[model samples]
Target: MATRLQSKWFRDNSRLQHCLVSDPHHVLRGATGEHVSLIQGALSILDGSRIADDEQKRHLYGPTTENAVLEYKKRRRIINLLYQTQADAIVGKMTIRRLDEEMKAQERSRSHLMFAVGVSLPEPRMVILSETANRDFVGWANQMVKLYSGKVVKVDAATDPAEEVKRIRQAVNTAGAGGLLILSVGHGVCIPQFGEQGTFDLAPNAAMRVLGKNYNENEPKDFVSPYYDDKPAANTGLKPLSQKDKDERDQTPGAQRRLKNWALWQEVCKIFVDGKLSAVVLLTCRIGGAPLFLQKIAGQWRTKMIAYKDQVGCYQTASGRFRTILGKDKDKTAPPPPPHTNTPWGEITIPLSMTDMVVIDPPAAPKTP
Candidate 1:
């Protein structure tokens, strides 16, 4: 197993000076003493009887050193193959430069640092009722946010969806771009528009309405009635509305309203269109499975999206799955778990291209020991 090291350790190349090839004349082949030892140590190839036979302290240009150099040359050839270039067995400035480049690449690959934004269904909308479930979801979301170095922006249920979107946009703008926006909502529904073939419409506050149905056995209650009946003309049961009454009713100011999914999608696109956001992950129930819906937004925004391809269960299940992906804490001694599984509860990545939706299936369950 490869031990993880700090980035600074690799960034500082001074430690490699002793092992680095200095003299142009002192090459690996037919080189005796410290030269052979230094080259072998630099490449981390400790596989020879001569290397273990340290009692003599004699660095002889033996078969062991030659074999190590040969192996190193072969590795370089493999790298050259990738670039469609001819490979030479000799090590020189070119080889040292490639090694340095590889170290820098390693440093980048090991960096888990990131910045992110987390958005979740607020208050009444997230009526899971179970405190444990809610806590687990919040914890899991926070864990992911921390893993990516993000901050959570709470959106209250009382706030209009449009206003929430505006706030999020402002936050992204203020934070200065190139991060993630993670949205955890309820079930996603597609409403068809009359003339729009690929576009889907949505009723105001659709997430609350749809999610409420899952939480309650009774009919989903509304924050306010869609119809307005507070006017004085209603006293006359069958009377026609006067122009003045109509104007007054139209002028009457009401509460701010939530936007439909299409409107929400538009708002999201506006924020991410300039490549400000590298990725978006919708942690909702069924949005991942909606290919048409996902394709419509992904195609327009050109941002990658990670979402579930099936109905993600309650917060508990969602959190559990996230923990599994991030790795379990208990049994750190055990081998690392596979990233993918065969379960229906897998994450799918919708790329910028409409045709290339990649599904990462879950790995099979481990057999009993």
Candidate 2:
């Protein structure tokens, strides 16, 4: 039920004659009549000569006629360097005005639409854990940012979960509205409860440990410091933990630090669900049961969500191995395969305009995590 403009009525009314095109003087309509000939003549004049054949011009304003008008508009736009003109496939006054303008002048002047290409427009933003800022992840994030002309914000692994959420909220606010927010998390763990939606934690395993001389005997030996290797020293002796110490360590405030996925979603909704963002891409592992929460929230805010279904590989392959796989003498100028082939990963997209979610099952293999 799109609104249609009655160009014939406007042409008949003297009051609306000012809005009609003077050059070629035609009232274009979507029906079969003599007005179609006038439209064809106007299109032909705009093209600098006759474009449509006589037989085609005499026909109704069907798909072929519409396509011809569109082709003429496209060619004129290219030749005249016009950017702001709408390509509505209709011969209107604005189209006539654009055709009358000097091509040289169009080239010399920048359209107001062209001036706002990258500036003052919303750009994608990313937040990643410092612990997971490996070479592969950082390179991939940089590539995505460049691809979308976006911005990136890094979250420190050492920051408390609450403070981390605050930092992320601040980053989303800084990113502004009408853009995508990519949250790349690492070492996520899912905690499940019976008859309840599970919660996903984004705390890296390396952060759940005691550091330096402040080692707790109750803490698990499985915890390793990311900064240094565990080597036996004369002053510091590694000892087995007692049952009491283990219980105490489990109950410790720091030991229980984990980012709840639901809580993270709530925080993100508070900051970004202002009906401004286009979408949120959650690039994390084991995003189980979170899509439901996201869908409910997205429905309320009229935003979209893109979530991964399983673990995404973020580590880079060795240089030697990579070269072997791609062949050392491969042609650099050759085009890569199409993106829709050999699907492996899965993604779910919840569009703002639709009630049902769209699931891209086994989508093209991810180029980067």
Candidate 3:
């Protein structure tokens, strides 16, 4: 049923061409004679290749040809299976120019891609930071990409946080998605920056742009503050980093200059305001209850930012210790495991609060014309 042009596309890609000709019955009637010659050519190519003996050669090539034939029988449901299979070969070729333009024109105007700069610890060492955590985060992130139209890239555990943030911002800007998401986790410190007039609290502002007026402004002046009450609304018990911890943190490789948790959190807020992000989620302690100056944005109070002070340990430790806890249950049948689970570390769901931001949008509406 393929048109002449479509059949030609399949023939151009060697692997897909081989697959198409593997089964005589599935190929177009017009290509039958060519298909026979193709088979002869393949046999000739194999004749000179590295095959120890007739028996081994026959065993390998025989099943490969047979499997291809069987698989093609079911591939006919595809509207343009040949074209889809050959898309890569013809990507830069003239054949797809019109189709490619039309496809780009139809894409959503909003950007779906987001980027996050995550830190496991202040110094990138001490405490418990592992490759296992990065792998786990990447796996969950890929699932999120599948749910959404755009991709999500993470920069974490970088040797240089400032440079890493710069690269991430550039990539996301190039992607031009509707919104962005940024998450940073590590030790939160409060420190003073020496200035012309007086000392100012230094916030996290390396390689950050778009949260305030111009791109690359480091001051944390424009933002909103959430009022922390005695009652536990989101249950994140946030507290300021003590002076002792701040001094110790300053000695860390990346923390030579003292940085406050509030300042670091504000960079996330800028993403939403700069039209680069629809939502931003911070997975650190004391982010929600930051001081008034740090929290005020555009002369209004902004409180949606959720911060769980000292809760990262809870999530990681809970899942890490799941094996022990489940064993203690002593019940015979275990419940179903969480998605993409580490056998030892049960399934992970971003805390209920952050799940809303992670959900993917549904596919488009059918053509109504």
Tell me each candidate's RMSD, in Å, in order.
Answer: 18.4, 19.1, 20.3
lDDT of 1 by residue, 34-95 (tens): 33433443344122223334311244445555555556656656344545465444444444
Model 2 segments more than 4 A misplaced? 1-135, 145-159, 187-196, 202-268, 286-290, 297-302, 317-369
Ranking by TM-score: 1, 2, 3
Candidate 2 is scored at a TM of 0.35
lDDT of 2: 0.38
Q: In terms of lDDT, which candidate is stronger, 1 or 2?
A: 2
For residues 1-369, what per-residue lDDT tens digits would candidate 3 score against the true structure? 222223211233243344433443332212323232233222222222222222121223333333332333223222345555422211112322222222223222212121111111111111111112444444444443443323344443332345433443443343333333335433222122311111111123322211211211123442112221112234456755543345454565333232433344345334334433333344333323332223333222121222322223222333232111121112212332222111221122233222112222222335798
Off by over 4 Å in 1: 1-133, 148-159, 174-176, 189-269, 299-302, 313-369
Worst 10 residues of 1 by lDDT: 122-131
Q: Model 2: number of clashes?
A: 0
Better of 2 and 3 by TM-score: 2
lDDT, candidates in the order shown: 0.36, 0.38, 0.28
Clashing pairs in 1: 33-59, 340-362, 340-363, 341-361, 341-362, 341-363, 342-362, 342-363
- Residue 292 error for model 2, in Å? 2.5
TM-score of each: 0.36, 0.35, 0.29
Candidate of highest TM-score? 1
Candidate number that wins on lDDT, 2 or 3: 2
